[model samples]
Target: METLGEGDGPIDIHDYRHGLKLLKETRETSLWTNKKGYACPACGKPFEQLFTSEKQHNTFSPSSVTPFCIRREADRVLMFRH
Candidate 1:
């Protein structure tokens, strides 16, 4: 794995690898969202929320859900109805 950031970025190689390992080994049921994004446990790769849908909220299993964070660009912040 490669280091994701140089100075003070959210991701690093270690965290990214750890996150990938955790994703494969663990079955997380709840989805966690944050504004600053999350660093992968093994390798430091930033994971962000790319998309969300309220209609599919209860339809999918928790194990299949991938927790992500939101990164605000400029002054625009995107929000979804839950």
Candidate 2:
């Protein structure tokens, strides 16, 4: 994964937010952020965030869910949904 602002070409904030929204909406559980830029606990790779879906394969029923932010662990992404 590449940083949103550091790439060959510039990307619009809309696109970035759109991707995040898609991940959040499609994801089964929730999205996780590896802000610390450390290896994932499960995969062991440097990531800014991780998406954990409660449903397998990021499948979900209704697609109206919204994403929320996690506190204290700004470096890591946490499950915002139940």
Candidate 3:
């Protein structure tokens, strides 16, 4: 199966978190160290931290939601919602 951030497909939460862990291991912060107008999918509240959730939410109701973090430093993109 194609892994998250590998193929031209959407990302999974578990895979997203795992990627974060790997990034953390190499550095103290993320490579996409900037926000590119990221916001909440449900409420539209702007935020920076692209986090994962295992609880009830609007975007992925029920449970187990794997969101993305699309940010922009100068001219890039990141992701997240919660």
Tens digits of lDDT, candidate 3, 1-82: 2223443444343444432332222222232211344334433554434533222322434442445444333322334533
For model 3 the local lDDT of residue 61 reads 49
* Model 2 CA deviation exceeding 4 Å by range: 1-28, 57-82
Q: What is residue 21's positional error in candidate 2, in angstroms?
A: 14
C-alpha lDDT (0 to 100) for residue 2 of candidate 2: 35
- Cα lDDT for residue 40, candidate 2: 30
- TM-score for candidate 1, residues paired by index: 0.24
Query: Where does the lowest 10-residue lDDT sum fall in candidate 2?
Result: 68-77
Best by lDDT: 2
TM-score of 2: 0.30
Q: How do the candidates rank by lDDT, highest first?
A: 2, 3, 1
- Show where candidate 1 strays beyond 4 Å: 1-28, 49-82
Clashes of 2: 9
Cα miss at 10, model 1 (Å)? Answer: 20
Clash pairs, model 2 backbone? 28-54, 29-53, 29-54, 32-50, 33-49, 33-77, 34-48, 34-49, 40-45
Each model's number of backbone clashes?
Answer: 18, 9, 13
The CA lDDT at 24 in model 1 is 19
Please give the range of 10 consecutive residues that has the lowest summed lDDT in model 1.
21-30
